[model samples]
Target: MKATLLSGIPLLIMTAIGIALIAQGKSADGRSTLAVGVIIAAVAGSSVIYQIGGWDLRRQSLAHFAIMLVTVLPALLLSGWFPLDSISGYFVVIAAFLAAGLVLWISFYLIFTKVVPRKADSSDAVRMP
Candidate 1:
Protein backbone atom coordinates (compact mmCIF):
# COMPACT_ATOMS: atom_id res chain seq x y z
CA MET A 1 0.00 0.00 0.00
CA LYS A 2 2.73 2.42 0.93
CA ALA A 3 4.79 1.66 -2.15
CA THR A 4 1.70 1.93 -4.32
CA LEU A 5 0.83 5.28 -2.90
CA LEU A 6 4.36 6.54 -3.29
CA SER A 7 4.48 5.47 -6.90
CA GLY A 8 0.95 6.50 -7.77
CA ILE A 9 1.23 9.97 -6.30
CA PRO A 10 3.99 10.93 -8.71
CA LEU A 11 2.02 9.50 -11.56
CA LEU A 12 -0.96 11.56 -10.62
CA ILE A 13 1.08 14.71 -10.14
CA MET A 14 2.90 14.38 -13.43
CA THR A 15 -0.31 13.60 -15.23
CA ALA A 16 -1.85 16.72 -13.76
CA ILE A 17 1.15 18.74 -14.80
CA GLY A 18 0.94 17.31 -18.27
CA ILE A 19 -2.66 18.30 -18.62
CA ALA A 20 -1.89 21.76 -17.33
CA LEU A 21 0.99 22.16 -19.72
CA ILE A 22 -1.12 21.10 -22.63
CA ALA A 23 -3.73 23.58 -21.62
CA GLN A 24 -1.03 26.23 -21.65
CA GLY A 25 0.01 25.33 -25.22
CA LYS A 26 3.06 23.21 -24.34
CA SER A 27 1.71 20.06 -25.88
CA ALA A 28 5.04 18.45 -26.76
CA ASP A 29 6.61 18.82 -23.33
CA GLY A 30 3.36 18.00 -21.61
CA ARG A 31 2.93 14.82 -23.62
CA SER A 32 6.45 13.65 -22.84
CA THR A 33 6.05 14.34 -19.14
CA LEU A 34 2.77 12.50 -19.15
CA ALA A 35 4.43 9.51 -20.79
CA VAL A 36 7.15 9.51 -18.16
CA GLY A 37 4.53 9.55 -15.45
CA VAL A 38 2.78 6.53 -16.99
CA ILE A 39 6.03 4.57 -17.18
CA ILE A 40 6.90 5.35 -13.58
CA ALA A 41 3.43 4.39 -12.48
CA ALA A 42 3.69 1.03 -14.24
CA VAL A 43 7.04 0.22 -12.61
CA ALA A 44 5.80 1.28 -9.21
CA GLY A 45 2.57 -0.61 -9.67
CA SER A 46 4.67 -3.72 -10.39
CA SER A 47 6.34 -3.34 -7.01
CA VAL A 48 2.96 -3.05 -5.35
CA ILE A 49 1.93 -6.27 -7.05
CA TYR A 50 4.98 -8.00 -5.63
CA GLN A 51 4.02 -6.76 -2.23
CA ILE A 52 0.53 -8.17 -2.53
CA GLY A 53 0.51 -11.09 -4.96
CA GLY A 54 3.14 -13.32 -3.32
CA TRP A 55 3.61 -16.26 -5.73
CA ASP A 56 1.65 -14.69 -8.57
CA LEU A 57 3.83 -11.70 -9.36
CA ARG A 58 5.76 -13.32 -12.17
CA ARG A 59 2.63 -14.32 -14.00
CA GLN A 60 1.14 -10.90 -13.47
CA SER A 61 4.23 -9.09 -14.70
CA LEU A 62 4.65 -11.30 -17.72
CA ALA A 63 1.02 -10.89 -18.65
CA HIS A 64 1.31 -7.15 -18.35
CA PHE A 65 4.42 -7.17 -20.53
CA ALA A 66 2.84 -9.35 -23.13
CA ILE A 67 -0.33 -7.30 -23.25
CA MET A 68 1.60 -4.10 -23.67
CA LEU A 69 3.63 -5.62 -26.48
CA VAL A 70 0.70 -7.09 -28.38
CA THR A 71 -1.82 -4.33 -27.86
CA VAL A 72 -0.29 -1.07 -26.79
CA LEU A 73 2.62 -0.77 -29.24
CA PRO A 74 0.55 -1.79 -32.22
CA ALA A 75 -2.10 0.65 -31.22
CA LEU A 76 0.47 3.41 -31.00
CA LEU A 77 2.02 2.50 -34.31
CA LEU A 78 -1.29 2.31 -36.09
CA SER A 79 -2.35 5.60 -34.61
CA GLY A 80 0.20 7.07 -37.04
CA TRP A 81 2.08 9.04 -34.45
CA PHE A 82 5.43 7.54 -35.46
CA PRO A 83 6.90 6.19 -38.68
CA LEU A 84 6.64 2.47 -37.95
CA ASP A 85 5.72 0.99 -41.34
CA SER A 86 9.22 0.00 -42.47
CA ILE A 87 11.29 -3.07 -41.50
CA SER A 88 13.75 -0.94 -39.54
CA GLY A 89 10.86 0.79 -37.84
CA TYR A 90 9.36 -2.52 -36.82
CA PHE A 91 12.77 -3.62 -35.58
CA VAL A 92 13.10 -0.49 -33.47
CA VAL A 93 9.67 -1.00 -31.96
CA ILE A 94 10.35 -4.64 -31.11
CA ALA A 95 13.75 -3.85 -29.69
CA ALA A 96 12.38 -1.06 -27.56
CA PHE A 97 9.59 -3.23 -26.19
CA LEU A 98 11.97 -6.10 -25.42
CA ALA A 99 14.38 -3.75 -23.71
CA ALA A 100 11.67 -2.23 -21.59
CA GLY A 101 10.32 -5.62 -20.59
CA LEU A 102 13.80 -6.87 -19.76
CA VAL A 103 14.49 -3.89 -17.55
CA LEU A 104 11.18 -4.29 -15.77
CA TRP A 105 11.74 -8.02 -15.23
CA ILE A 106 15.27 -7.49 -13.90
CA SER A 107 14.04 -4.89 -11.46
CA PHE A 108 11.20 -7.12 -10.33
CA TYR A 109 13.50 -10.13 -9.87
CA LEU A 110 16.09 -8.18 -7.92
CA ILE A 111 13.66 -6.41 -5.64
CA PHE A 112 11.27 -9.27 -4.95
CA THR A 113 13.69 -12.21 -5.01
CA LYS A 114 16.72 -10.50 -3.54
CA VAL A 115 16.11 -7.27 -1.63
CA VAL A 116 12.65 -7.90 -0.23
CA PRO A 117 13.50 -11.38 1.00
CA ARG A 118 16.58 -10.08 2.72
CA LYS A 119 14.52 -7.47 4.51
CA ALA A 120 11.88 -9.96 5.61
CA ASP A 121 14.27 -12.50 7.07
CA SER A 122 14.43 -12.72 10.84
CA SER A 123 17.96 -14.20 11.01
CA ASP A 124 19.83 -10.94 10.87
CA ALA A 125 21.12 -11.24 14.39
CA VAL A 126 24.28 -9.34 15.23
CA ARG A 127 27.46 -11.29 15.94
CA MET A 128 30.29 -10.52 18.38
CA PRO A 129 33.31 -9.01 16.61
Candidate 2:
Protein backbone atom coordinates (compact mmCIF):
# COMPACT_ATOMS: atom_id res chain seq x y z
CA MET A 1 0.00 0.00 0.00
CA LYS A 2 2.76 2.42 0.96
CA ALA A 3 4.77 1.55 -2.10
CA THR A 4 1.77 2.05 -4.40
CA LEU A 5 1.04 5.44 -2.92
CA LEU A 6 4.66 6.51 -3.18
CA SER A 7 4.75 5.42 -6.81
CA GLY A 8 1.52 7.30 -7.56
CA ILE A 9 2.92 10.67 -6.50
CA PRO A 10 4.77 11.20 -9.75
CA LEU A 11 1.72 10.15 -11.76
CA LEU A 12 -0.45 12.69 -9.97
CA ILE A 13 2.12 15.42 -10.39
CA MET A 14 2.56 14.70 -14.08
CA THR A 15 -1.20 14.60 -14.65
CA ALA A 16 -1.57 17.95 -12.91
CA ILE A 17 1.20 19.42 -15.03
CA GLY A 18 -0.38 18.03 -18.20
CA ILE A 19 -3.71 19.52 -17.24
CA ALA A 20 -2.06 22.85 -16.60
CA LEU A 21 -0.36 22.74 -19.93
CA ILE A 22 -3.63 21.98 -21.69
CA ALA A 23 -5.44 24.74 -19.83
CA GLN A 24 -2.72 27.23 -20.72
CA GLY A 25 -2.98 26.22 -24.39
CA LYS A 26 0.67 25.12 -24.26
CA SER A 27 -0.27 21.62 -25.31
CA ALA A 28 -2.12 21.16 -28.57
CA ASP A 29 -3.89 17.90 -27.79
CA GLY A 30 -5.32 16.81 -24.49
CA ARG A 31 -5.42 13.23 -25.71
CA SER A 32 -1.66 13.21 -26.06
CA THR A 33 -1.30 14.33 -22.45
CA LEU A 34 -3.72 11.68 -21.34
CA ALA A 35 -1.77 9.02 -23.17
CA VAL A 36 1.43 10.19 -21.52
CA GLY A 37 -0.16 9.96 -18.07
CA VAL A 38 -1.25 6.40 -18.81
CA ILE A 39 2.25 5.46 -19.90
CA ILE A 40 3.78 6.94 -16.76
CA ALA A 41 1.28 5.15 -14.54
CA ALA A 42 1.96 1.84 -16.28
CA VAL A 43 5.70 2.17 -15.87
CA ALA A 44 5.39 3.11 -12.20
CA GLY A 45 2.87 0.41 -11.36
CA SER A 46 4.83 -2.37 -13.07
CA SER A 47 7.61 -2.04 -10.51
CA VAL A 48 5.37 -3.64 -7.91
CA ILE A 49 5.87 -7.05 -9.52
CA TYR A 50 9.54 -6.77 -8.71
CA GLN A 51 8.71 -6.47 -5.01
CA ILE A 52 6.77 -9.70 -4.75
CA GLY A 53 8.27 -12.29 -2.40
CA GLY A 54 9.67 -15.75 -3.30
CA TRP A 55 10.53 -14.97 -6.89
CA ASP A 56 14.10 -15.03 -8.12
CA LEU A 57 15.51 -11.82 -9.53
CA ARG A 58 15.41 -13.02 -13.14
CA ARG A 59 11.77 -14.05 -12.92
CA GLN A 60 10.77 -10.84 -11.21
CA SER A 61 12.60 -8.71 -13.71
CA LEU A 62 11.07 -10.56 -16.65
CA ALA A 63 7.60 -10.14 -15.21
CA HIS A 64 8.18 -6.45 -14.66
CA PHE A 65 9.47 -5.94 -18.18
CA ALA A 66 6.58 -7.89 -19.71
CA ILE A 67 4.05 -5.80 -17.82
CA MET A 68 5.72 -2.61 -18.92
CA LEU A 69 5.79 -3.74 -22.54
CA VAL A 70 2.15 -4.81 -22.53
CA THR A 71 1.00 -1.52 -21.05
CA VAL A 72 3.37 1.01 -22.58
CA LEU A 73 3.40 -0.31 -26.14
CA PRO A 74 -0.30 0.28 -26.65
CA ALA A 75 -0.14 3.63 -24.93
CA LEU A 76 2.66 4.69 -27.23
CA LEU A 77 0.72 3.56 -30.28
CA LEU A 78 -2.41 5.38 -29.21
CA SER A 79 -0.44 8.53 -28.46
CA GLY A 80 0.39 8.89 -32.17
CA TRP A 81 4.03 9.46 -31.34
CA PHE A 82 5.08 7.45 -34.35
CA PRO A 83 3.69 6.34 -37.69
CA LEU A 84 1.14 3.71 -36.82
CA ASP A 85 1.06 2.25 -40.31
CA SER A 86 4.77 1.64 -40.53
CA ILE A 87 6.27 -1.69 -39.45
CA SER A 88 9.67 -0.12 -39.03
CA GLY A 89 8.21 2.45 -36.65
CA TYR A 90 7.00 -0.30 -34.34
CA PHE A 91 10.32 -2.09 -34.55
CA VAL A 92 12.00 1.13 -33.51
CA VAL A 93 9.67 1.57 -30.58
CA ILE A 94 10.14 -2.03 -29.44
CA ALA A 95 13.89 -1.76 -29.75
CA ALA A 96 13.99 1.43 -27.77
CA PHE A 97 11.75 -0.05 -25.08
CA LEU A 98 14.00 -3.10 -24.76
CA ALA A 99 17.10 -0.96 -24.49
CA ALA A 100 15.60 1.24 -21.80
CA GLY A 101 14.26 -1.76 -19.87
CA LEU A 102 17.67 -3.40 -19.91
CA VAL A 103 19.32 -0.33 -18.43
CA LEU A 104 16.72 0.00 -15.65
CA TRP A 105 16.79 -3.73 -14.85
CA ILE A 106 20.56 -3.82 -14.55
CA SER A 107 20.61 -0.74 -12.34
CA PHE A 108 17.97 -2.11 -9.98
CA TYR A 109 19.71 -5.49 -9.84
CA LEU A 110 22.99 -3.90 -8.85
CA ILE A 111 21.35 -1.70 -6.22
CA PHE A 112 19.48 -4.53 -4.55
CA THR A 113 22.21 -7.15 -4.74
CA LYS A 114 25.32 -5.03 -4.22
CA VAL A 115 24.35 -1.95 -2.25
CA VAL A 116 21.68 -3.43 0.02
CA PRO A 117 22.62 -6.10 2.54
CA ARG A 118 20.59 -9.28 2.65
CA LYS A 119 18.92 -10.67 5.78
CA ALA A 120 21.12 -13.16 7.66
CA ASP A 121 20.02 -16.74 7.01
CA SER A 122 20.78 -19.97 8.95
CA SER A 123 23.83 -20.58 6.79
CA ASP A 124 25.21 -17.20 7.75
CA ALA A 125 24.67 -18.01 11.43
CA VAL A 126 26.85 -21.13 11.16
CA ARG A 127 29.54 -19.62 8.97
CA MET A 128 32.24 -17.22 10.14
CA PRO A 129 32.64 -13.98 8.22
Best candidate, lDDT-wise? 2
- TM-score of candidate 2 to 2 decimals: 0.68
lDDT tens readout by residue for model 2, 2-74 = 5466458766876787788789886746557766777778777776776788998779877877777787777
- Backbone N/Cα/C clashes per model: 0, 0
Residue 87, model 1: Cα distance from true site in angstroms: 6.7
lDDT (Cα, tens digit) per residue for candidate 1, span 2-104 = 7678668979998899899889998877877776676666555555444554557667676567656654455444433456667988777678767877886
Give the range of the ten consecutive residues with the poorest summed lDDT in model 1: 72-81
- Tell me how candidate 1 scores on lDDT: 0.68
* TM-score, per-candidate, Cα-based: 0.60, 0.68
Residue pairs of candidate 1 with colliding backbone atoms: none
Total clashes in model 2, counting residue pairs 3 or more apart in sequence or in different chains:
0
